[model samples]
Target: MSSETHEFKAEVAALLNLVTNSLYTNSEIFLRELISNAADALDKARFQALVDTSLDGQELESQILITVDKQAGTLTIEDTGIGMTREETAQNLGTIAHSGTLRYLEEMQRARAAGESSGAVEPNLIGQFGVGFYSAFMVADEVVVTTLSGKPGSEAVVWRSRGDGSYQVEPGSRSQRGTTIVLTLKTEAKEFLDRWRIEALVKRYSNYVMHPIRLRVIDEQGEDKDPEPRQINAASAIWARSSSELEDSDYTEFYKHVMGGFVMPGDEPFARLHFTADAPIQFHALLFVPGRAPADLFQEDRKALQLYARRVLVVENCDTLLPQYLRFVRGVVDSQDLPLNVSREMLQEHKSLAAIRRQLTRKTLKLLAELAEESADKYAKMWNEFGSVIKEGLHTDGGQRAELTELLRYRHVADTDDGLVSLKDYVAGMGEDQKYIWYVAGPNEAALRNSPHLEAVRAKGEDVLLMSDPVDEWVLQSLSEYEGKSFRSVTQGELDEPAEDEDIDDKDDDSDDKDDEAKAKDKREPSPIDPLLNLAKVVLGDRVRDVRASKRLTESPSCLVDAAGGLSRNMERILRMAQPGTKLGASPRILELNPDHPFVTAASKISETNKDDPRLAEWVEILHDIAALAEGTVPDPAGAAKRFTKVLNNLVAG
Candidate 1:
């Protein structure tokens, strides 16, 4: 038969140049691309054989074979699958983004719409963007494709191209069905001719391909030994199998494979969410929450979740599939609904992907909720490992705040041991007089439990949640309330006195006596602490918004509180640490004093005796500095140290 030559379409010529140079980031991607195309062809042949019994490859087992000839510096990939005819080869390969699988699916959809097709039989295939075939030019100098159509009477055809904007078509004489691609490796790409390198690329990208992928190595000593083609891929598609048939060990093994040994060999996942969804979008997933988090889990560029299309991997670390907060989740998601670009290295921004993400997030959260309810001990252990990361979701995903809140666990001020409290349990135990959910944040649980801001609350037998995680500060900023109750920081805003449960008598008889006692006490006391408060405000100047007596403080001499609707002290400190020199952390806070404390009493007496006393101003400055230190910050270390030394010297002299 005569061979014919044709120049690529002008647009295709420009596109071919892009595919060979810039389309794929790695040269090794060409192997995965070719394997995916071969797998797609195999799928089409299997589906066609069901309807047409005369197909040529119906009796042969479908598999992909990779052969390396190190002597010739060439690699060949052959598959026992459907092959293309002369016209189909030119149309499918000579163009960019013209997918054969997409066309086949469209035809099936049209058939179903016209009542010509029956049942839900669909082709499960990959290679959505036909340009995957042209990725070969990224590594090869010349490429040759020899294929024989699976159609009974169809003849074999050969396609040749140097990827220089021209291609040749010629008649082939192969007796069996399917296609074979041979690549003459360029000088720099000869590493692909090594057997170990070929094995690695296959396992990395196509380890779970539905069909067996076999490899053969022909050394310089010739093919005298190792006659049989050994299979390289697992070909199990573990996620696609029925969960009922899979054992726990099987799941663990697959998790280890997918996670690339990120977890220890014997370490089991804390929880696993395995389910198949068909309504919103068809997908099979196996998600695992590792028992221990990686050291780099919080890195900004860390990736999670492997995304696959019909068993062929589309992306190794699909960051788009899960939000950054859920980046600790490790597993595989296999779906055919996602759209891929030319290299299949990245996913296109499609509505289906968004739907998948929403579904996966809801499912993951639900799994955590179930774990917390059904298994307390196990869930507690998992929470201890990942609670800080999960708390981030409360601030980022407002829509799921309620669900996330149910998963929160915190140390309570009343807890003597390491026991944790949940919002639901805390709300149930709340006193009728308690109007808001009170919480205190500090450097550690010990510091937070002993916080002076919770003194009055403890005296009233009310429990305050203790938070020590650094992320807890930012988390509380967005989590304003849980379960119809508002969240209040014990260190923010003016402290409100808890309402007394005792009922007041309606009789007017005792009203005059109570009023007389109050008037006499007010006349005698005459607001002795008022002088100290006014003097401290003047001494501190704009460093504090106001200085006043605290209703919340009992043991501590002083504490800092932000004004109503102002940023909490802990949150401001976190912001300053994350972004140094940020102006957002410069808000002045209110300083509240405990008038009953000895230090406060002595300072008040000094101010009453003489407002200009040097000791009075030094004591006020020391109180402010101590309050700053209590909140895990240092406003002015040098000035505070000098004042502290003077106070110590005066105490010794007295």
Candidate 2:
């Protein structure tokens, strides 16, 4: 056969450079990549025949065949796919010329410059990149492609490249209407010639590939005679199987596969939600909550979700299936109704995709809730590992806030140190006099459990929810109330028990004459320390929105609470940490002092004894820092250190 030679396109050289220079992490992915390309080509051919009868019913079985010649160091991959015409062969092979290919290339080029050649390319641009095909050149010294267009009366074309700077195209003698690629393998790639090795690679990456991948075997006794072709992959979609037929081990193994061999931290999935949907979208997802979160689960960067359209892989790790709050979920979501050529932008706005996400989120929450009820131990492990991540949903995904709230668990003042209680449990235990759910957020469990804000609540025999997670404050923003009871911060505002009607009447008859004298005394002499509230307010005017007598504090001297409609101390701290150079611009927190506390009483005497002493103002500043420190914050490290030493010295001297 006579052939014509053509110089390689400029982009082809750059693409070859990218591939050989390391566009992929595993070299063996070249085989997987090439096989995937063949399968996609076959898919297009099969789909075309659905509308064009002339192209169907006569072509070879829609299957992929791979043959290896060890001595010649060549391997051939053939597929009865919609083969390319001459122009397409040059365009697709010689240069990147599909939709979004330029953008994909530009992105890859940027990633390549940052030494991230393995960075992601958009899923929908898999074929558009025209780069997966070049991956074959990673192991091959030369590549030859012979293709016959599926169109009737079309002539065959063969494309050849030597992994060098030139390629050739010529009229070829081929009766079949498909594509055949022959790779002259490099000596280092001879391992691929082993039948078992090929089988293993097929199972690892292409087991779920929709079409059959058959390998031609050569018998040891006679290399000339070929053995019957054997199917090397499962070629069946795993998630589409009925739940009854699947076992826990099956789901575990599949999770490992989809998640790139990530063994869930506890060597088990926290839970698995496997179900098929045919309503809004024809899709099924096999999602697992890892028994423990990965080290990078909280990071913004991660692999995409294993997004699939039909049985073909769209992206290995797609972020669109569920929101970032659910990033710890590891699994695959396959949609049968999504178009093969769906773009990344299209996917983000896709109605089917949105529907799938909604359903998956619901199933995930439902699964977690059921696990909490049925398997407390498993649910505890999950909460210990990923509860903070789940809590992020309370602030991010408003639609799921109610469901997410139901799954929230926390340490309660009433429960044992290791125990957790849900909101429902807290509500169930509430007394009739309790009209609000109370909680306090601090830096950690120990701090919250011992918090001064909790003292008053405990006195009334009411439990206060202990919240230490950073996301807890945000959760409280929109979740102010549940089941008709408002969520109130224990340290904020004021608390008063309901007045007893019987006690009021019983005391009324005895108090008339005595009340007159008691009221006269109260008007003449307030608590000795009450004057300090006014004094501290004058000294720390704008530093605090208000200085008030304590309603909750018992053992502690002072504590701060957010003003109405203001950010909590914990929330402001988190936001400040997340955004550097961004001021909190906070209005002063309300500082309340316990007038009965020994420290306040003693400080008041010192101020009363030396009315003009500046030490009173210094005491106020020191109190603020101490209160801030108790709340797990540093108001002024240097100033606090100086004031702490001065106060300690003064007390020791006295």
Candidate 3:
């Protein structure tokens, strides 16, 4: 029969340009696509043979054979499974049927322009778009495929492509069933003609492909020999194995193998979770929480788990398997049930995929909770290292907030120095009358523990959760309440509850009720210092949100707190510094003064004894600066220095 050349579909041309020109900088991944294709072909043949027993007892072993011809500068990957008839080869190779091609192309175009994620080929995208067959063009100048159908009397076919714009198909000479792809490596890509390079690429991308990947091994001798078959790929998927038959060391070794360079050498995994889901979706996962955080955990390229469709590695860094907060998790998600579009490159957005994600996240959080309970010291170390990342989910995922909240722990002044307490424990310890769960968030322990905002509550012997992580404030903002107790920032709002040892208990029966009188006295507003507050408010002007004598301040003269609905001072500072062009201006703060302090008493005297003393305005400004400094801010240090100089001069002159 006469051979004929056919033009590629327009979309196929675009897809070719993306792989060869933009994404295939390494070029070795072409082998992975070919091997994955071989695995797929074997799967089809195995299914057909099972249905029609007429094909039984043939050499039914499913394996992929690869050979390198150094002299010819070519690589051939041949599979022993279902081969295509001439008509089938022409039809499958000539057209693009995958619906996600346009979507994948749009994403790739954006990625290339942004210089993100464009460096590596996304295995699933290739499979989903059904363009993986054409990926060989990335490394080869010419590709030829020879195939014979596994069907009873179908003829062999040879498809040839220079991958410029056209391909040719004709009857082939192959006797047995299955397909063989031969690549005439480009001059620049001739490195793929080496046995070692082929082996390494197979191990990196397709080592776990279900079919044996047979490669001819070269020994130390310089002589060229006949092909002695050896399986290059493990051909066994780790997740497909039963948990009962596998040991921790087996899982550990598999994790290390899968993680490759992403995980640190010699570090252990914190935990491993293995399970299979039959309902909602059929999937098996071997998830591991790395013992040490990846050095690149904070980077945009943080590695994620591989996604496999039916043991054929489909997606690399399939982050949809877990949320960004759990990007540090390393493992495999193998599902025979995920409906991959033709070409197995792009997964259609199915309800089952979302359900799978929800299930995995729930199970992961449960595993962490179990670890925290069974091994507090170990989990604490993990929290100290990774809690910052976990807290991010609280701000981003509303549905998982409560689960994440329970999984979180924090160091507190209330707990022993290094120990942490959960919100549950703090709530359990709360007095029957306490209305909110109190917390103080800052940059570090020293800043938080030294904060004047915590003083009055500490004086009352009420505990406050000390949150030092920068993410803690944002997370608490998103997680407003847990189990009915609203989070109240000690640095933001007033505390109404009396001290734990205070006499509300004694007032149960009108027993002398000295505590009742004290409570009534404390309930009295800033009426005692109204004139002093008025004088300072006028002098400070818009510099302060409003001046008030604080019941929260006992040891310090003044402090700053957030407005009723506003973010905390520290949280604002963090936002302004971390984000550019934020227009955060200065956080509007209420300057609260300790009315009982000697300085305030002296300040009251100034308002009463010398209403026109210019020094009065100066001291009010000084108090504002001091509060700023105490709040860990450098608000006008030079101006504060000049003002302090004037204050010293006035004190001596007076």
* Model number with the top TM-score: 1
Backbone clashes counted, model 3: 8
Model 2 regions more than 4 Å off: 1-63, 68-73, 79-180, 183-205, 210-234, 262-265, 342-349, 496-528, 538-543, 585-587, 602-626, 633-654
TM-score of each: 0.88, 0.69, 0.78
Q: Number of the top candidate by lDDT?
A: 1
lDDT of 3 by residue, 1-654 (tens): 777888877766776677566654446667777787677677666655655566632676788988877766778889887677777776677764442333434675797788864254333322444566777888888999999887787878899988777889887888888888998988998778677888888887787787788886333353444457777888887788888888877787787776674456656787889999999888999998888887789998778888877666667788788899988888889886687754445568999889889989999999999999999988888887789999999999988887888888977777757688888888898888677788888777877788898888888777888888888888876877777888888876445644233345435554443455455446656566677888988988787767777878888988887665466677876898789776977756788888888877887888887778877788888888878888678578999999989888977999
Model 2 has an lDDT value of 0.76
For candidate 2, the TM-score is 0.69
Candidate 1: regions farther than 4 A off: 9-12, 94-99, 118-120, 265-267, 497-528, 534-543, 583-588, 602-626, 632-654
- Per-residue alpha-carbon lDDT of model 1 for 1-654, expressed as tens digits? 689998887677788888878988888989988999999999888888887888887789999999998777789999999898777888887666788877888898898899988574678877766788898998899999999888878888999899988999999987889999999989999899888898988988899998999988888656623489899999988788889999998988787775676567545788898888896788999999987886679787776888988888778888888887788998989996776776778788888899899999999999999999999888888888899999999889989888988999998887878788899999999999888888887667877876788888889998888888889977877877777787777887655622122133442444553463343334443355999999999999989877888878889999888665456666776887888876774677788899899999999988888989988888999899888888666778988888889878988999
Query: Cα RMSD (Å) per model?
Result: 5.8, 11.2, 10.0
| Steric clash pairs (candidate 1) | none
lDDT of 2 by residue, 1-654 (tens): 467777776656775676665666567767876787787677667655765679833557989999977767788899998787787787778763342234434775796799866443323223444567777887899999999888887888999998777789999887788889999988899888888898888875677887899998554443833577878887888898999998878887788876667674556877888899989777878888876677778676776568766455656667888888888888888876664432222354557777888898888889988999998878888999989888988888898888898998988889865788889989999999887788888678888887778888888899999888878887887787789778877865546522211133334554553363344334443556766777898988888877767768878888886654356777777788788698766557878788878878877887777756788888888778877877777768998899999988988999
Q: How does model 1 fare in lDDT?
A: 0.83
Worst lDDT 10-window in candidate 3? 118-127
- Ranking 1 against 2 by TM-score, winner: 1
| Cα-based lDDT at residue 163, candidate 2 | 70
